[model samples]
Target: MDFTPGPQGQFPGAEAAPRSAPPNFIPEAPQMESRTFGAPGRPGVPVSPQFGFVRPGQIRRCIHRYTFIWLVNGNSFWFYPTFVGNQFVQGFRWRRNRWEFERINLRRILFFRCF
Candidate 1:
């Protein structure tokens, strides 16, 4: 904004200040579409590691069911779910001869395959 002094060269005297132009936003920020399991996506989007599995459901049905989960941090695990909640899942992870109990955030898992 450009301000011009009035008669006595005082501030806010007579003439109003010029309006500044609106910021140009189109070039500064780019737009992208969210991707599905097999397609390309942004940073936090989960990726499906293998084929033959459909989208996992609300987690309640996973009791005693074997599952493959890929997390946002690029690590994947085979887990057996025991409980399910809106934002988290409690389960046992498969390892060398044992299933260890763990509680995990649903948001951290990129894609979950239930079988």
Candidate 2:
């Protein structure tokens, strides 16, 4: 038996469901500039690498989670999932050289400019 629900089954008292736009409804456009930081041939900055990864001064979202992360200089910043509205209130940073992970509070960071 098919487990899928029909339109009326999903939403009661609603009319026939509206058709969805085509998957490629919006045309693709070429990127005007590189997303990587610094000029080409730089030591730290390199051209765009594979997905799900990034270099220094670059940010990327996790493939399977709502978390976002970035690396600047030698420090790494992470924004974990939070229920406190749309803002990220909890996270931690890893200091590459110091080998320490510090908790981050977005409220304090925004108010005091701590990070």
Candidate 3:
């Protein structure tokens, strides 16, 4: 009546040796998207042939949020750089406010650069 395998019970096709967890391996939670294309190198460095399924403007907003999260919490939900979420949107807005203040001081610089 017992279902537990015993020392002599053979499990067909089972490995002979009891499996050991890999030293450097960690189990990852299941995710919605299995893959993503992302910008290379560092932020603000500008990537050519920009990657991701989202639009460029939206990508910028998401990237801005991702960097803010990394700076504030040392972690981010930006597992895939292209995917945007509610939290990322909020973070982006917070960052955008600070960026707005900084931009105000550089209005002349921006004007000159554009011209």
Candidate 4:
């Protein structure tokens, strides 16, 4: 029995398999991406220069990985900014002699410097 629907677009019957693929199925696998944030921008930019942290829009513009991130818990580290989403910034952190991926919320950043 042909499972594909005809021009009428009516199901053959309930006993046969579904005419369409499962909802979770995809036609093609997602491709891995390699992105370059471009040449290093002006470093030493302050994250919270006055009273607030920089918004995602400003961080998105600086994609270079030289930004110094200081979390709200007094933990500070320097990492390469890879992807900046609406609420979070994703990047690779140097750990154990290897680049480990890390994500941080834009709001949790207390101090940000790009030096």
Error of 4 at 82 (Å): 1.0
lDDT of 3 by residue, 50-95 (tens): 2222233433443322221222112222111222332221111113
Ten consecutive residues with minimal summed lDDT in candidate 4? Answer: 21-30
Query: Model 2, 1-115: lDDT tens per residue?
Result: 2324466553211232113211222222212335644432343343333321222112212211223333323332333221122212322222332212233323222111111
Every candidate's CA RMSD: 24.9, 18.6, 21.7, 19.5
Give the higher-lDDT candidate: 1 or 3: 1
Off by over 4 Å in 3: 1-32, 42-56, 59-115
Please identify model 2 stretches exceeding 4 Å from their true place. Answer: 1-44, 51-70, 81-115
Is candidate 2 or 3 superior in lDDT? 2
Model 1 lDDT tens row, 8-77: 7632312222132212221211122353434223333333334212223555566666766666576776
Instruction: List lDDT for all candidates, in order.
Output: 0.52, 0.27, 0.24, 0.52
Better of 2 and 4 by TM-score: 4
Candidate 1's C-alpha runs over 4 A off are: 1-57
Query: Would you estimate the TM-scores of all the predictions?
Result: 0.51, 0.21, 0.17, 0.51
Residue 13 CA displacement from its true place in model 3, Å: 66
